[model samples]
Target: MIRKLCIGGIGGVLCLLWGPSGFGLEPFAPRGELRIVDTSPLNWLSIALNVFERLIEIDIDGNLDPGLATGWRWIDDRTLEVTLRQSVVFHNGEAFDAETVRLNWEAYAGLRQPQMMGEFMNFKPGSRLEVVDPSTVRFRFPEPDGAALVKLGRLHMANRQFHEEHGWGEQQWGMLNKAGPWGTGPYRLMDGFSSSQKRSDRIVLEASRQYWAAKQSPRPQRLVFDNTLSRQEALQSINTAEGPVDLVSELRPVEAMSVAQSSFAEQATKRAALVTVFGQLNMRKAGSPWRDVRLRQAINLAVNRQELLGDIKGHGVIIPALAPEGAFGYDAAVTPYPFDPDKARQILQEAGYPDALMLELIAPEELQTQAISISMMLEQVGFTVDLQVLDAGAFQRQTRLKDVDHPPEQRTWDVALRSALDHLNFPPFLLYHDFALDGPSDWVGEEPELRRLYEEILRTVDREQQERLIRQMERHAHEQASFLYLYNPAQLYAVNKAVTFVLHATTLLPLVETSVTDAHWSVRKISGQEGASETRSAQADWNNAEQVALGEKVYVSFCAGCHGANLEGQPDWQKRLPLGNFPAPPHDETGHTWHHPDQWLFDIVKDGGQRFAPPRYRSAMPAYRDMLTDEEIWAVLAFIKSRWPSSIRAEQARVDARGQ
Candidate 1:
């Protein structure tokens, strides 16, 4: 859309002004130089992997493709038709159609995305798409689909004249610090990274070459997002300060063995890992009604997945995954909340609220591991629990105000969330429709038979009759307790292999299936450019950039008051407001802290994000264990990898491989 691909490095300061007291890595893609990191950012409308496109993208391994509707049909069962794909385009060059998919489903069923992406809009957004002209399009659907390609694979086209010329409602599009590079895919965007103002902390995509469905991953001549907050401070501001993660999604197999004891420990690669950090339980928080289902199955048996495996390291952080563990029609004989508190105090007196029932719980105090282990397993069950901890912009303005009745200690926190539907594509549309309550409160779970078995698994592409109707809606969401299908989590990234990707697994995150040949290859030319790569070379990039500038002076003492002063978070994170509850999580690399694992990122910077989210509890995250130190939790994980992605310093030397 705005082409420019020279790629010749501005005379690399005369090669660092004649050097040897020297430092290295100077490729910066095809050339105009683009230091990567953004370990996150690019929420790109629910997830098609930030560079954008939808009408089916899927990946991580689930695979799917087509994005932007290249082909579709039906004309009946209520009509489908689709078509569009005439050399797709968007980053503003405009030109993709059906009135930009009916003005992005009339701005995703309007009310201006009140609680974000209109409950991740699984299509039918005020239904329509019609056009039947400019590259066709028809979709009708008053009903009777048989699940038209999983509801046109939860349709997504966007750019309806650029969200009606950027009027973006859903609370000014969840207060973005940046994003409008808009999709056509393959990649676009060039001038934005903290240009000092005009609100751009970072952004720089490249690879389009008139993209329509370009493949073989080859795109990267540049990508830099930089946004940063802490995946070890974006790998200590790109070691010597460069960026764009090669791999590093959410580390945790014992923090990938302290990056395999640093010095890029041969880019730690015990089987090239990726994806999984699981947790979710929006049980539709009917204000504070202890989410009834017998106090949500007595807070899922006061959880103790082996007390989070001595604080997370990888391989089955407790096994159990009632559903989400690797999500895909899941069904291991289900167990909504096993581990019993004497049947969780006999289901808290069969829901009559027995022995003591006072509740209040909210999380994301920046995920101190599910808000300090479910606030200590909801204070070991008997109830009377209270832990609010807001910050991600007042917990996304109290989950877009799904106030749900209120009362039990004046509402606002009852069952709490953990949902990890992980950008679902029919895992009961994020397992049991966000944990049902009744209907229309965004995030999900108002259950009209889990939204009619998510419209009977979207009328049916018949993947075994949509896995026998999503195993009868995950066994009616575990006999109507709604959600707690925990332990399907695992997404611990920590690569230092310099860069490579086909990075399979699918809860989203593929980086257009990454790759690289010369940003200075060696490590035997990156194990001969990929014949089984993972490769590394770091040696602790200058002691992780001086312990991430001494963990940004303890991240300006207690993380710039709820993650900001350049972390660009909170403010309205996603808008849960009124009194607040869950939105603030954008510590650059978008979030999940470079996916996590320097011992759960040094116990969440010495224990805070409500100490790894716990027992449906409260938190605004504070616990730096009497204020930081394990070398100040590896210098705030080297200031969260100085904000991530120079192939995550070669995915930290090919997953800390340290020769094997």
Candidate 2:
């Protein structure tokens, strides 16, 4: 009998017990424990350490794989249907069902300051993710979202009964001295802590027999997270053998290099730990000095990226950026800030600022990269940088605060460094955060045309239309100079030989797939040992990198003004050719980069993008071929690729196959 089921996915989501609850939790929890120095309840926004995952998990490729929601599909373009596994239970043995789903959203939705809501739609209690049945539910969006399934990864649904039974506040989840707020993950909570102003602490998860995912492979033997949240301590902990801490959140290239060369007991580099480090200037006030493009340019030119990179890291690191130049394209945009104090002086003078102005620079205390040096460099250009270092909680509070009076102009944060976790997907909804939407000042906010275009973006599901709209927004954002778009960072994490964890650009590490053992080495490291060809190919060519660095400087000296960063082509890479071919393909793996063999790759770096293309192309991608040696070109490419993920190389390979 074919039963036509009209199921709504988000509503159908459920968690319940599958197997009999007999021997409590078995010995199948994750033993591959790692330590993050700080895991604060307040750290909810910047980092949560993936406390729990729902049915659909976000994969390394930025795709959503089946998680708590074993299977999901679209009911209609405007709605989504999800089916939950029948036998899953929460950590506290509460039956996972439609009620649990409803409650989790209800709690999170009610909170005035939502940590997860901004990622997707601003979820409201009345925002209706209605339950359909015990095992089936539907997420009725206002419009279609193909990425709806993946979006579930961001939602760590909790046990409705457990949370309501307990309540929140000083007795809240992950508090100063306890671990509550249980979910249906592989591990059940044994104990926990909360977010604070000082140092961070850890939480322990015991194997859960009631957990639905545990039925698949009985979970891990044990899972322990020493959520320290301090990078320095995490780096130290990984060196110890079977200590309190095991894994660290972020390590710069220099740190990675230190691990690579150190005689530490256990160490490994978790791939793709990169993140974009950008300069976000608050452009709310109209007559405010930063509204000037010349001032923005001067601010950009004042900081030397090379020096900043050197300060950030020396090895296992890349300076040029990889993603987000145009979110959809393979554009490895490399915009180097020349160390020209004279030029900066001239530009500032020309902009009517003979002396640098006074401004407040807002940043988190932990970020130590060449990225933040932009503030110091701006000081050289005559700007007084009144540095305001705030804890994560205070920052989030102010950023989200609306009605409060920002004390005079002196107390407000003038510029900050921030990133959009999933900017490519939900664009216009977050425009207010950047553009002057609801502030006392009349800064850059949504205009009539922009709002209309954003509406079209929300309703228009056609992939092409979406891309055009995103590009339009990107163009608008760039022209507004709301942000300096410093550099999209490449993520990195060092692991001991004890565990294997997958990395994702969209989210942090997926601890569910990770496994820890006393194994001496992985097949990955064993195969790519020092003498092997794989190692040779993977071997970083820094001398060549040095050459590329030199050549890039030469290119920047002559080009960059028109060509854009590392030949990103221009702000308008889309509106390129009448012939349907771009004037300049991105230097990223997408552009015609993979089109040439190693020989031509060498030539173009030395020659320039202009030498080979026909007259009609008129590309601004100036020829570095004349300026650089063959090794330098390869080295420069190597530097750029260092920031790009392994997935891009595979795409480039396929591009090579097409012979375009």
Candidate 3:
């Protein structure tokens, strides 16, 4: 049967930019702009995903909810039926139906580009989305996937009519506006917001008037995004009172604190984020020393997790596995490796490395401080460690195994620090992708046990049985010292208190539920209750002895690497060397840090000293915004200040008084 569904477009409606008015902001005609950081899809997928919609939408809590596909049900172990939502229209006046699903799934699968969305979702090969009726579709898979529903939650649907007409490209959406590919999402990309334009610094998204859902939060007249703006530049724009900026997207901890302390932003709020930071040891490469299970265990035992992750400001729970706490496969009983240098040494010696084992440690530029600390720890346990720090892009390419054409030497290091997970709920997916015998990263055909266990979990249909199987796999991997687990950093945002914004677990800003005047009123009503608790916590004296001890703990975890354990920084700290950057300076009296005020030091620690410096200035000191909390920052500062002589502290106290 041939079916032709036509969706009509609504007539033109005026767009009002909702700028901030007084406290009791009454909505006048739209006048303000929403400035967001749309840098890269990899770093900003949360925003891009919100800009588009899938058949089944995964909510902020990571549960499947109704989207283009109204609901779905498993027909059997390998077949599923999905009911589509009718009367939904794409931006191009195309009515959505079951064929829309089929066309989009096919096109997405055929796309030659390496999109983060595609890799993250892990679309099944040979699976087809077939039309059952005008409003229903069915999916037939070769094998039963434990995360089939989760995969469906990631299958974003697009208008077939639009894509066929315009053709495909990396920036197809950006190139064509209403005439190009479109989704039934809440926001529509405004025309002429392309990169080719002379003033193409921004990507504007106006609210969709043709949206089917009822309005919950008062809709923004228009949501303007500036993709070109850096974090530093965005903050500068928000600081201007009469500026067109109404909202500022993701801010680092230091930047948020800076905005809160200054007259620019009203308040900064923190939320728990769903991100993990860990180290992956490549068991595949035969040339790597970590091939021995005993050696891997020794390396894991040598790590002082407390000194590595403790005192981090907003870092949430520190665990042994990448899975979040209470997640399906996370086994709380399986403890993290303790800091035992002696045991590590004994294990290394027993593993046939009596004198010392040599290794290369790979890490991103952001994790240089961590790499340095890890190197020292391994050295203490009688391992000769050489740390290699690469920029984000280079680091990814060097560590990635290119399959048959890519040789062992190209795989670089034995161990590397990385922050990721393929599926948040399924540990088996991560294990399969990174370490299974035939996996890309697994250069050597090792870990038959992990492969066997992961395959078993994939075949298991029962949820309870799946979780139990996952737990068993995680334990086995831990016992083999497969991967060293680390802490999950908390997600945070700094916003103008005028706008009501909620940061979700996925860290995407809730644009649909956000309103300027409405958010202001809401904040005012809840301030008294939430404010009292905040006030009490903020009142803790950082100069006290207890606070100093707290700071010492924080400094050991984060600062001791570059700044030296005794607070005496790197050699030639003041010299601007080959990289056009100075080495990390001492925090003691001998250093110039005491010459500055408390707030000055705080800014340096939170945002990095290079942030406020010249435009292209570089620094090895990574921002501790999401990693460490404000209190922890103060504790670190207090610890540094305590080490200074009384004269230096008194001089800094006078310097701090000038700001008051």
Q: Please provide, for model 3 over 69-99, each residue's C-alpha lDDT reduced to its tens digit, 9 standing for 90 to 100.
A: 7787878877888899886766444568887
Q: Which candidate's TM-score is highest? A: 3
How accurate locally is residue 617 in candidate 3, as Cα lDDT from 0 to 100? 57
The TM-score obtained by model 3 is: 0.65
Clash count in backbone of candidate 1? 146
Q: Report the C-alpha lDDT of model 1 over 65-151, residue by residue, as the tens digit.
A: 566777776656677776766645564445666667666655655653443423443444445557768777787766655544644
Predicted candidate 2 versus true structure: per-residue lDDT over 86-188, tens digit per residue: 7565543346777777776666556564332333343323345767788887877665663454345555667654465553432132222334326666544
Instruction: Quote the positional error of residue 67 for candidate 2 in Å.
Output: 2.6
